[model samples]
Target: MTIEWKGVMPAVTTKFTDQDTLDLQMFEVNINAQIEAGVHGIILGGTLGEASTLSDEEKRILVKTTVNIVKNKVPVIINIAEQTTKGAIEAARKAEEDGASGLMMLPPMRYKAGDRETVIYFKEVAKSTHLPIMIYNNPVDYKIEVTLDMFEELLAFDNIKAVKESTRDISNVTRIKNRFGDRLKILSGVDTLALESLLMGADGWVAGLVDAFPAETVAIYELQKAGKIKEAIAIYRWFLPLLELDINPKLVQNIKLAEVATGIGTENVRAPRLPLVGEERKTVLKVIENGLKTRPELPDYKNSDLM
Candidate 1:
């Protein structure tokens, strides 16, 4: 299937209340806001969404809510990474039934797999669902590398159509583009590498900061696509500090902080992922303050609403 995935696909967060119940309204509100802001697509239950912490029922709700809100206005990619192939496949089936446009899958974590084993894990999921697969190579979180060779092996499966390259290496991105450019779509997953990814050869970006700054990310990407290189770079530079800050394991906290400071989602993330406080809060605030200082004077962007 030819799934046209492109532009800013936010790995959107699942909003939670102070009592830790899912704030479905806030989540839908943000999804609507992101769609209205011109996001190309949405990837629910990814790292930014705190997928690792959510229960299966919560995930179903998140996906169902997103599909209902988006209404096929754009593609929806659901990240399904579990310890067992069966669980991942089950989730993918449910996501397709719930109306996800495709599935982004990561191999089982903690227990590292060899090349053959990794391929087997994904191939099992690929066979289970008709939804397109986005092979996720997130070495930091999963501790397993989906190497170029492993990718080539996975590509033999009819459903594995794309990849989310989170390794943050531009050369590797170039290599993948050169090799599999014709066969599969490659999405840049690292926020800091979004610009370089586009410039180097990535088809799109799965942006974490899009939770708060969809316009900036989409604008830079659209600018470059339109061949306005200088304009794109200007925005890229303006966005670097914000992007760099997202690489922190405290990404959920940082994005929520941006959401709270600006007029986006709440600063409330689920526990284990606490709201920033003490020096951490001060550090994030300083970074944001400095980022805003260098940010271009776009009219109405820095208005009282975002403040």
Candidate 2:
């Protein structure tokens, strides 16, 4: 299947049982909600999905299950974050073999590679699989900025198709458009910047908090695309405090808290990560509660068939 690489693709949180096992039943429930809410695609094992802690076998299960549940209703993309180039290639190939529609790849994990090494890592992985790739360029979190020059090097492969632009320098959205002119499709990776990125020509959003409020997330993107800027901003402003949750260090915990309040997912995460508690938990829940109180009456919108 051809991945469209556009519009409100939630970096879905991986659900786990109390025993820390993959909760496939609850996962399918959440995925069905996303589809019903009109999300364009499903991304598994992403940052929001706790890719860093998931085992390879677990990741493959995620990819296969998502693909099966989605049933071609949307593309199922898996994230590949590994420390070694060979490991990255193996993961990418595994995603393809497991029936993923695309891959969202980060630069080599842990050791921040220089520009040269990063380019080589991406190109080699792209060479190893036929799956389309969305290069995740989030210097603020990932520490390796995929500069336009580096992207120029990656253009040799047609499968290296899109970018998840989380540089946090919003102007890079414009710079990417100015420089690449659709040669590279850009998806806003930051929730707070999603509106600005769309206005500036980003083709889509790989959202975080969308896991909690799928209808509002899809509505904002659809309204913006339809030129209802004022309507879009109203929802975005109401959403800002909660959207801010996506950028913080504790995003996974924060978002899961929102999910539990909204229903459809659990707050249980793996080892080394705990559910939010005390004032931190209260503060996040307050934001979600307040947002819910005034939640916009979302107009019915269909999923973008922009592909």
On the 0 to 100 scale, the lDDT of residue 172 in model 2 is: 93
The C-alpha stretches of model 2 lying farther than 4 A from their native spots are 303-307
lDDT of 2 by residue, 41-134 (tens): 9999888899888999999999999989999999999998899998998998898899999999999989989999999999999989999999
Shift in Å, residue 268, candidate 2? 0.4
Tens-digit per-residue lDDT, 1-307, candidate 1: 2367677889998899888989988888788878877888889888888988999889888888887888878888889879887787788889988878888888886568877888999998888888988889988777888899888888899788878889867898778878887587878999988888888878888998878777787777777776667878888888888888789889888988887665778988877877888998999988878776676753333233432
Structural similarity to truth (TM-score) of each candidate: 0.93, 0.97
Residue 157 C-alpha lDDT in model 1? 92
Clashes of 2: 0
Highest TM-score among the candidates is held by which one?
A: 2
Clash count for each candidate, listed in order shown: 0, 0
Question: Which residue pairs in candidate 2 collide?
Answer: none
User: Which 10 consecutive positions of candidate 2 have the poorest summed lDDT?
Assistant: 298-307
